[model samples]
Target chain A: MARAATTSDVFNAVAEPRRREILTLLVVGELEVGAIVTALRLDQPSVSKHLRVLRETGLVHMRRNGRHKLYRTNAPALQPVHEWVSTFERYWSNQLSRIKERAEAKMKQSRETGTSEKES
Target chain B: MARAATTSDVFNAVAEPRRREILTLLVVGELEVGAIVTALRLDQPSVSKHLRVLRETGLVHMRRNGRHKLYRTNAPALQPVHEWVSTFERYWSNQLSRIKERAEAKMKQSRETGTSEKES
Candidate 1:
């Protein structure tokens, strides 16, 4: 199957660690391209390239402030990614393991005392 | 910078839509390679390749079941991804918008009635 273009898909665009870092930085508030480059310690061209992919995928919004360009995260664009990953939340939550541990401990105590646990 | 290998990173492993589909199917329960191939309607080799990547990334676990290999999701491995994406939850949540809407409506009502609202 053909791969989705990284510039066109939010998931693909965010797959790069640098791009993820950029999004995290923008979350603090909007920043100029030069600010992002300085904060991330990356070269101008590389940052610009990532910004373009993020802009294309709608992960970040850009605006002009006179002579400068400001960028901020368009966080709503990440909702689909968040929702899809959240579906597996139950599988990873510690609550299930905690419950299992309590049950096993109770069972062990009952076995040692030879007493049946009363149903609640 | 060099890219992380898909076989080693959960995020990259799931970037492919087909792999994401496979993981969703595994969430139902463990399935054999043949079962996954049939359920996903992909070629055997393609399914096998995807399964290998999933296993290497620890997104899925495979165990021998006599003549077959059974696969199940290693959902705990997805915690990092869930945690990372969840940081942006507040940005997309409707609660903020709802609160803003209510405040705006109240302000509009107060203006129309020519009265100040009492502080709660």
Candidate 2:
């Protein structure tokens, strides 16, 4: 029995620049396989391979529309990726405050040292 | 000369679960090499290798303090990863609206077909 792709697979799938570009293209609107190949200027086999990886990652989904398979971004699976990256938000937000405090404390120490030297 | 790690490298580096755990650990405060090894319960060599990869990826930094090398998360390097992942934000927000519209349209479509069948 085969299980559906898990969220962790998405992290590695998106590591490639070309795959990310492919995802960006799909975000605009649904397109057929031929259209993706032409737009990205990639060879058919390469584009197909990337699309397969993206599909397996569950970041994109496609459906048969007449003779064409229309593909579009499946944004829900990206939730795990977003959540994992957001974990670092706390560190990013606090960085500014930490830098400011360090600078101010250094200034205060310098001023106090000068005063003590003058007194001596 | 080898180039320093770029933002893309950080994406690949943090893709590993253990690496992400290491980053999470550093978020609280700085820790010395020995402390990180003990806290994670990983061997010194394994932790050292992970630290090297983290440093090369620019996601972590170390400064020599006496005999110990203090390590901490370099939050700024994570900026690019954050920004990249955020591009999907528009898609995520729009998904809810799209799903609602689809559901409503399906209901309306079913009612219209039912009415037409009754007329026929």
What is every candidate's C-alpha DockQ against the true complex, given to 2 decimals?
0.59, 0.26
- Assess every candidate by TM-score: 0.81, 0.72
List the lowest-lDDT window of 10 residues for candidate 1 chain B: B1-10
- Residue pairs in candidate 1 whose N, alpha carbon or C atoms collide under 3 angstroms: none
Off by over 4 Å in 1: A94-120, B94-120
- Model 2, which residues run further than 4 Å from truth? A1-8, A96-120, B1-8, B94-120
The CAPRI category of model 2 is: acceptable
Give a tens-digit lDDT track for model 2, residues B1-120: 222233347766776666778888987789998998888898899788888989988889999999999999887777887888788887786778888887777778778776432221
**Interface root-mean-square deviation, each candidate:** 1.3, 5.5
How does residue B108 of candidate 1 score in lDDT?
91
lDDT of 2 by residue, A15-99 (tens): 6677888888998889999999999899999888888988988888999999989999887777787888788886887778878
